[model samples]
Target: MAITREEVLHVARLARLSMSPAEADKMREQLDNILAYIRQLDRLDTADVVPTSHAVEMGTPFRDDSVHPFEEKEEILKNAPDREGDFFRVPRIIED
Candidate 1:
């Protein structure tokens, strides 16, 4: 399939692009080549092939989720510049 200069101009207009006549001619040739390649691919027989999202088969490698207790709350709070009770305090951002 060949892409015409008119089609290229129409596409460029849709994309709001401004190109010179030379650029348009170049784009037409490039688009035509791309379309020709795609048309060539249409001739391939893949009726029995199953569709896959990835080129290679892979499985999710996940470890068992385990809960661990953090016993250093006081140690972590000791480094806070502004501590309020058991938590770090910050400037109030919301206004009533």
Candidate 2:
């Protein structure tokens, strides 16, 4: 597929890019080459090949989730500038 100057200009407009005539010509050539490479891939015979998301097999390496209570609540609250009972007091942002 040969990309034209008009197609390049349209793409540039959609992308909100300002290109000179020389830049558009250069982009047209580059885009045409990329399309030609993809056209070459269309000629491949992969009827028996299975579709895969990744080139290599992979698995999630995540650990099991576990919960625990804080050992020292008073120690943690000591760092807060403003506190009320067991929680830190923050300034009210929204008027009800």
Candidate 3:
């Protein structure tokens, strides 16, 4: 699972990266270590274990996205640096 410098350079080229020889060497070592760790994980016996989606037993922790009307439109508009009739006035981006 050792990643070579040539392979690293090929990957960098495909990703449109301009890498030095030193960077390629560093990445090669890092990627080799990662692959070695994955190999260690592959050696573990998982014959009786069920694959889990979450590491912890969990609940749905998200809040509901409920739409609410503006209570005080004037309050929000007061803080704007540039405001129109009822909305924030931004610079005209589109050409006529």
Candidate 4:
């Protein structure tokens, strides 16, 4: 499909662009070339192409799910700058 001068002017106005008379002609030609390329692409045969969700096959690796408690809490808390009893204490965060 070929884009018209009126179409370019209307689109430019909608996009809030201050296009001069020379710019409108240049934009019309550029848009027409892009549309012509799309028209050419549309003529390609893609009937045998299979639709795929992913470019490559995907799967999660097998792993046994397990839960465990910390063996030495005091040893880990020794590196903290601030601590309150059995837990680490930090400054409060206020989002504006």
What is the lDDT of every predicted structure here?
0.90, 0.90, 0.88, 0.88
TM-score of each: 0.46, 0.47, 0.47, 0.45
Off by over 4 Å in 2: 46-57, 60-96
Per-residue lDDT of model 3, residues 1-96, tens digit only: 577889999989999998888988889999999988888877889889899889897887997899888899899999999987998998889878
Tens digits of lDDT, candidate 4, 1-96? 498999999998899898999999999999999898888867868788777778887796786787687899889999999999988888888888
lDDT of candidate 4 vs native?
0.88
C-alpha RMSD of candidate 1: 12.3
Give me the runs in candidate 1 sitting further than 4 Å from their true place: 45-96
User: What's the true lDDT of residue 29 in model 1?
Assistant: 91
Which residue pairs in candidate 2 collide?
none
Off by over 4 Å in 3: 4-17, 68-96
In angstroms, how far off is 63's CA in candidate 4? 25
User: In candidate 2, what are the lDDT values of residues 1-96, reduced to their tens digit?
Assistant: 478899999999999999999999999999999999888867888898888788878886886698687899899999999999998998889978
- The per-residue C-alpha lDDT of model 4 at residue 54 equals 83
